[model samples]
Target: MFTIAVDFDGTIAYHDWGKTPQFVPGALETLTLWNQQPNIQLVLNTMRSGKYLEEAIWFLETHGIKFVGYNQNPTQQKWTSSPKVYANLYIDDASLGCPVTKPDIFTPGGRPYVDWAKVDQLVSEMVLFVEPIHQD
Candidate 1:
């Protein structure tokens, strides 16, 4: 299975503190599609903690985005005690080379956010490259 770590704020939703912000356009659809893939396991990776983290979890659940792990991969603890979450891929607004939309009215604090359309396209291309080859 391939593990994918995804950030919450700024990546999935607008970067707003103390309150849940609107989901980035196409974020739900893209994540939902990934969640349905049998070979893909998603983990929520973010800086949020305490009640804030709970809120994010609630938001995802309410939106029907089911994930396998949170912050740390449950399967990783068996092999190592590292604090960092391990994944074949990571989707975060802060990640370099990640497509992001320019600051707009929807963005909080005037900060740019993830561009889901570009992200989806890029991920689709990556999947095509890694898909298993079949022979007759």
Candidate 2:
């Protein structure tokens, strides 16, 4: 299976500290698509903790965004105990080479936000090359 680590703030949603930010354009649809793929496992990787983390989880659950793990990969615990979540791909707005749009109304003078449409396309293409993992 291919694991994908996703960021909440700025990546999936607008970066609004202390509150559930609005979903980036196409994020909901793209995430929903990824959730349906049998070969893909999603992990929520973010700096959020405590109440803020709970809020992020609530938002994702309400939106029908499914994830297999959070912060740490459940499948990796058997072999490794590293704090870093292991994923075939890490999707974060802060990462270089990730498609992003110019500053918008939501983020005045802030960094460019992720372009979900592009992300969706890229992920779709990548998924085509990955073979589904089967379990007994």
Candidate 3:
């Protein structure tokens, strides 16, 4: 299965920088669906460390988002000691060409966030959803 590395702050959740970030609208639902799929794997990719990392993990756990790895992948190290997580796609609010919502005061860190609605539509168009065969 292919892997998708998702960012916590600003991507799935709001970008509070230091404080705990809130979940972006529709993010929990979308990620939950992705996690349930059989052909996909998820990895949490973020810059947060120490207690901050724990908080992010706890947030996802509370939200019921299952993931395959965190920060770096175990298999990636066997090939090369790269400090990067191996993923077919990287979803970040800062990614160029990525759709995002307009910055507003209510947003965390007072910054814009990834427009999940648009991202969802784009992802749907990109990935062909094949019906799985049921075994008797």
**Top-scoring candidate (TM-score):** 1
Tens digits of lDDT, candidate 1, 1-136: 8888999988999877666567987799888888777878899999989888888898899999988888989999999999999998899999999999998774575678888888877777677633222112
Candidate 3 deviation (Cα RMSD): 5.1
Q: How far does residue 126 in candidate 3 sit from its true spot (Å)? A: 2.5
RMSD per model, one decimal: 5.0, 5.7, 5.1
> TM-score for model 2?
0.87
Rate residue 31 of model 2 by lDDT.
81
Best by lDDT: 1
| Candidates in descending TM-score order | 1, 2, 3
| Clash pairs for candidate 2 | none
Go through the candidates in order and give each one's C-alpha lDDT.
0.83, 0.81, 0.78
lDDT of 1 at 31: 86
Candidate 2 on 1-136: residue-level lDDT in tens?
Answer: 8899999888888776755468877788778877887888899999898888888898999999988887778999899988889998999998999998887565733656778777776776687853223112
Deviation from native of the Cα of residue 134 in model 2, angstroms: 28
